[model samples]
Target: MSGAQRETTEYAVPAGVLGLKGPVEKPAPGTLPLRGDLAHIALAGSHLAAHYVIPHVRTVGTEGAGLRLAPRADGEIFATLPAGSRFELLDVAGEWVWGCPGPQGPTGWCRASDLASAES
Candidate 1:
């Protein structure tokens, strides 16, 4: 033991219990490209998720695209993306790709085939 001792601090509650003091307001389901298990990398601090993913930039095909509430074709269409519109790709399942036009956006599902890599 040295003459200079380290100061120790303790918390009454367990580490896991330490978080925001009050209720947190979360964005609506279709309003953000965030799900219970995954979120956009840009939302890492603002939201909670088991994993955060960096978006892949993609552009709407010449025919344009419709952003739907669900992956299925019959799902409600909330937004329409014009041809060549830039999209931030988050998740993909079958024919649908889930993402937003930008970090702060009205996120939804669009046909994967309707989007082409921006690089191309």
Candidate 2:
């Protein structure tokens, strides 16, 4: 091995455990959290899990900010966020960003331009 260190995590369930809702996660760039059905999963060469993301919350910038099921204008609109509304930003793809209304609230994609950093 080179001077760089590689950390490997083990995922083994205890004996007699059953009825797991999701699969165990492999190493990821960030931490994985498990809640209901939402997950920050990537499958290039590993698996991942999901959970409530109350820490990475962001603000809805300007008026007419919309939270949609997909990251497109034609995506279904679930809610119209007011200026300064806070939501947990989950992922990003091009001009779109995935997020939820709150830690345990509904999740969807929103236009990245409509979102502002919470500290901004």
Candidate 3:
């Protein structure tokens, strides 16, 4: 998506609760399987996502995988998923898959090659 479109698609965390002023704090970037436009269905009511999804569960490969902040090799690695770890798969782009280790997560990008179907 274009930069402008991306900006427009982002969902802001809601401000205030019980008459407060500041925005409702969101969890750390990789700690919730939520982007401005999409979130895990389980987060409904707690977050606003343009669309909510039910993730497809996958398993980390024997070599394991690093969850990166961005969908590039050079992206920062925030979490290291051990082999056989369960991954909640959300979106995929090229060789990268965007997802979390679970509903409560350190969500980020992982190489598609690093994951296998649950049965694998």
Best by lDDT: 3
Model 3 spans > 4 angstroms off: 1-23, 117-120
Model 2 C-alpha lDDT per residue in residues 70-112, reported as the tens digit of each score: 5778877866778888756767789998766553345567788
Report the C-alpha lDDT of model 3 over 1-120, residue by residue, as the tens digit.
Answer: 344321221232333322434466777788899999899866765766689887888899999999998999998888899999888899999999999887788899999999975563
Better of 1 and 3 by lDDT: 3
Q: Please, what is the TM-score per model?
A: 0.77, 0.53, 0.77
Which pairs of residues clash in candidate 3, taking residues 3 or more apart in a chain or in different chains?
30-107
lDDT of candidate 3 vs native? 0.81
Q: Please estimate how well model 1 matches the true structure, expressed as its whole-model Cα lDDT.
A: 0.78
Stronger candidate by lDDT (1 vs 2)? 1
Q: What TM-score, to 2 decimals, does candidate 1 have? A: 0.77
lDDT of 1 by residue, 69-108 (tens): 8899789888899998888889989989999887787899
List the candidate numbers ranked by lDDT, top first: 3, 1, 2
Clashing pairs in 1: none
